[model samples]
Target: MITGDALLLRPWREADAAELVRVQRGDAALRRWTGAAVDDEAAALAWIAGQARGWETGDRLGFAVVAADARNCAAEEGELLGHIALKDVLSGDGRAEVGYWTAARARGRGVAPRALTALTGWAFGRGLTRLELLHEMDNTASCRVALKSGYERAGVLPAAPPEFPLDGCLHACRPGA
Candidate 1:
């Protein structure tokens, strides 16, 4: 597990399925960004299982963000601050696209930036030279997080927003590269 000052970055576990579904179900923002929550237990199980398989094969890096403890602003274990991960990683490219979100209840608390910084550290430690963060333009909060986490606005994509009504902005960053 990768430890941040106030959060825990760890692999998705089988037991997290039920609680994960419950946590995201009623949050419209999360559903818009992450897609509808799994309404059925079996589906949730399948989703978590797929995440496990992907991680084992190095196809994806999924980390659950949990509060350090009661004193931390983040949620407790069964609860999640959100998720941060690198996707579409290409071998020999030294680059990957990053995506992340904070649980609705955890928003406005600087959790996302902290999570991004932690993921940046982890990715750099693994030799990744470049990291990209993308978010719909409507998500100014995400934009702020990326900027605060040290990413520079690389460019914007028109009509890239799937759920939210906005364009998409791409931010790029690297660690000592």
Candidate 2:
């Protein structure tokens, strides 16, 4: 688990399924940006299971961001603030891609940047030399989070239609950068 001043980041659990479903179902922006479709409990469980598998395989690392004040509470009692992850990890190359989304109620609270900054520090401490953050060009909020978390704009990524229909910004970070 990662503990920050106002946030706690821990592995996702099966018990979080219902809350995940509710959040995803209610947040259209999240669904559009993440392409997440957890319309039911079953789907949410499957999504959580995938996160577990990612841990086992070491190719991805996801965390459930919760309010720090709820640290002593049970997983179900904690407020689910958001999700952040390091995906497409290439351990041998010391690199990975970072992604995240904040709960609607958590927006404007610095949730994404705080969680992302903590995660980035942890990743570097674990020997990851580089981290990449990508988001659709229109997602100015994510762009701000990336910049705030110390990721510098690297380049522009061409659009991949059907899935990513707009040009995207590519940001990168390295230790002390």
Candidate 3:
């Protein structure tokens, strides 16, 4: 389990499937950002199982955003905050693409930035040289996360979405590059 001052980034477990489904359904922003469909039990279970397998094989690393307040969940079933992950890892280049989302209630609280910083630091420590974050041009919230996490604003990629007129900013962070 990877940790930070106010959050914990732990590997996914089978027990977390139910709570994860709740989180995903509850957070519309997450669904929009990730384009993940979690409308039914079967779909959610399939997604969770895929996450567990990815963790087991070292293909992808996923993290759950747990708040620091112990009583938060126990007393109030506290906020899930959201989730973050490093995907499409390239072993030879030591690079990975980062993605994240914040729960609706958790928005504007800097959850994304904090989780991003912690994840990127852990990735670099594990020998990842370059971390990349891409987002739709209109996603101002994500731009804030990238900027606050020390990512350099790289130029836009034309014809990115192909079907949609989605121009995006490619933010990058390369430690000791």
Judging by lDDT against the true structure, name the best candidate.
2
Which clashing pairs does model 2 show? none
For the record, the alpha-carbon RMSD of candidate 3 to the native fold, in angstroms, is 3.2
At residue 80, candidate 3 shows an lDDT of 64
lDDT of 1 by residue, 117-146 (tens): 988998999889999888887888888999
* Clash-forming residue pairs, model 3: 73-78
Q: Which stretches of candidate 2 lie above 4 Å from their native place? A: 70-77
Better-scoring candidate (lDDT), 2 or 3: 2
On TM-score, the stronger of 1 and 3 is 1
Per-residue lDDT over 1-177 for candidate 2, one digit per residue giving the tens place of the 0 to 100 score: 887767889999999998898788878899889998899999999999999999999899999998877545344346899999999885689999999998898999999999999999999999999999999999999999999999999999999998999999999999999
lDDT order of candidates, best first? 2, 1, 3
Q: How much is the lDDT of residue 175 in candidate 2? A: 100
TM for every model, in the order presented, reads 0.88, 0.95, 0.86
What is the Cα-based TM-score of model 2?
0.95
lDDT of each: 0.81, 0.91, 0.77
TM-score, predicted candidate 1 vs. hidden true structure: 0.88
- 1 versus 2: better TM-score goes to: 2
